[model samples]
Target: MATATYQNGSLSAASLQGFVLVGFGGGAQAQALLFAVFLAMYVVSVLGNLTMIVLITRDARLHSPMYFFLKNLSFVDLCYSSVIAPNALANFLSSSKVISFEACATQFFFFSLLGTTEGFLLAVMAYDRFMAICSPLRYPVTMCPMVCAQLALGTYCGGCLNSIVQTSLTFQLPFCSSNRIDHFYCDVLPLLRLACSDTTLNELVMFGICGLIIVSTTLVVLISYGYIIVTILRMRSRSGRHKLFSTCGSHMTAVSLFYGTVFVMYAQPGAVASMEQGKVVSVFYTLVIPMLNPLIYSLRNKDVKDALKRLGQRHSLVRDGSQ
Candidate 1:
């Protein structure tokens, strides 16, 4: 049984200590509005990602390295949004934003894992594009089936390993005082702030590992794009250049949106955690990006558009033949 102590008419305890007074820093109306917005995003995100998965699986033409990575990206977006959107919606509806300690830890764990995986996977995709465009002759052998599989597996493993370090460090803190988390979800920064124990070690580990991963991946992506631009610039024929540009434009836009939001939200630690700004930034990266990824990729890709049209046409032709 959990013990409750009364302090100034507020019930508190060390056991369910973190589940005390809901969110200490937000209004009910605001929470409800935010919830509604995210609910729509969650719906779209799920449907869009599912559609991509179905399209890719059914379309034999999309069995190449590029589409394989895209399928994985869609799957990741589904899981990434699912981790937070449901709990966020629940928090908005319920009077208590109280999540159990174990639940909070689990949420943080998976969120960290998925987020890291996405960062690395995007970089891997950039490298794959680099190889395809900058070295078209070697694209086949360079990005072979086995190599693609290994890259995807490595991305997942890297994310999981980083998350294990972060989650373990986060939970190791001793909570002797206030337990109210300022944010809707159990984010590392906010959760660390609530710890009565010294968080220097945790912060160090968090910063060191996450910083290395983000910085290294960003650098690699930049260099890869640099080579790609040079290659594009070297093409003699205007039509050829235009064709290459069109092929890569959709992917470039996706990368820009994904990396831009993440870099803006997490690349720095300014007045965000203390003020309302962090929440807004978090919304972009956590909620909005996932929702937009599928739309951006599918709507922009020629292959996907063609596949959809073909699927519809094939269905219609079959029906007519049957008639």
Candidate 2:
């Protein structure tokens, strides 16, 4: 872990002892209440995402490109949420909310990588849906298993590159002003405020990279859906149109929930100014959204429901035979 060093009456990020995350400060009662709420949420997030992963991986019926993407999405949700929730939950009950310099950097690195990767994956999913709906015959060949794996790999690579740049720029500066992070977790925006030196470059690069990721992916989703909608409209069968819309509906909802919060949090220029709002927004994206995704995908989809039913039936059969 990089220790803080003092030089010339200033403390560089390396010289910093650590940071105090003043997470949702109200009082003992408020902290306790929030602790309970967030703990429940974290448990739900873990269980729901795990169930999705288990179901997707075990069930033969969910072997298509869409579920393949959905499985990865669940895994990302599982991972990225774990990166934040456990840390935040621990802080809620502790008297000291201090996190070491290296620890903070690690949190930001994984969070950025996983979160950004999900954005790219979601866009990839949109393309998958577009191909499935608009060019059904070509869909299998184009989105072959090899191609899908490559696309998933590509998302992680893009996210890693983005994380490297953001983490490098944000942490290399002097954190002499204060060792206090105003939000729940160690995000780039909050950390940027603590830098004593000029962060013009950091802000610019963050805006540029984050903007490119969000905007480009969002455009992919929108354009894909536009084509998907047209194709659905032209379908002569009512049931076919309904099924197509249903298939895309879950992805669209997930995209909307995930992307909207991200755009406001990262891409919006004024985001850093409001720490209180940032905390709420951060909580939503980090905790609430992950918990919601599995429910959104599963409740609205017939295949997952049937898979769950089948899995339950098989378990029951095994139990009865053993008895």
Candidate with maximal lDDT: 2
CA lDDT of 75 in candidate 2? 93
Question: What would the per-residue lDDT of candidate 1 be over residues 197-259, giving only the tens digit for each residue?
Answer: 678888778767767887999888889888988999998989777766776776677777777
Candidate 2: tens digits of C-alpha lDDT, residues 1-323:
24567776567876687898888978889989998999999899999999999998999999999999999998999998999988898998988899988899999999999999999999999999999988989989999999999999999999999999999999998877468898788998888888788999998898888899999999999999999999899889998888778878988999999999998988968864578888888888888999999999999898999999999998999999999
Specify the poorest-scoring 10-residue window by lDDT in model 1. 12-21
What are the TM-scores, per candidate, against the unseen true structure? 0.89, 0.97
* Cα lDDT over the full model 1: 0.79
lDDT at residue 137 of model 1 (Cα atoms): 97
Q: Which stretches of candidate 2 lie over 4 Å from their true place?
A: 1-4
- Residue 53 accuracy (lDDT) in model 2: 93
**What is the lDDT, from 0 to 100, of the residue 103 in candidate 1?**
83
Evaluated at residue 303, the lDDT of candidate 2 is 91
True lDDT of residue 195, candidate 1: 69
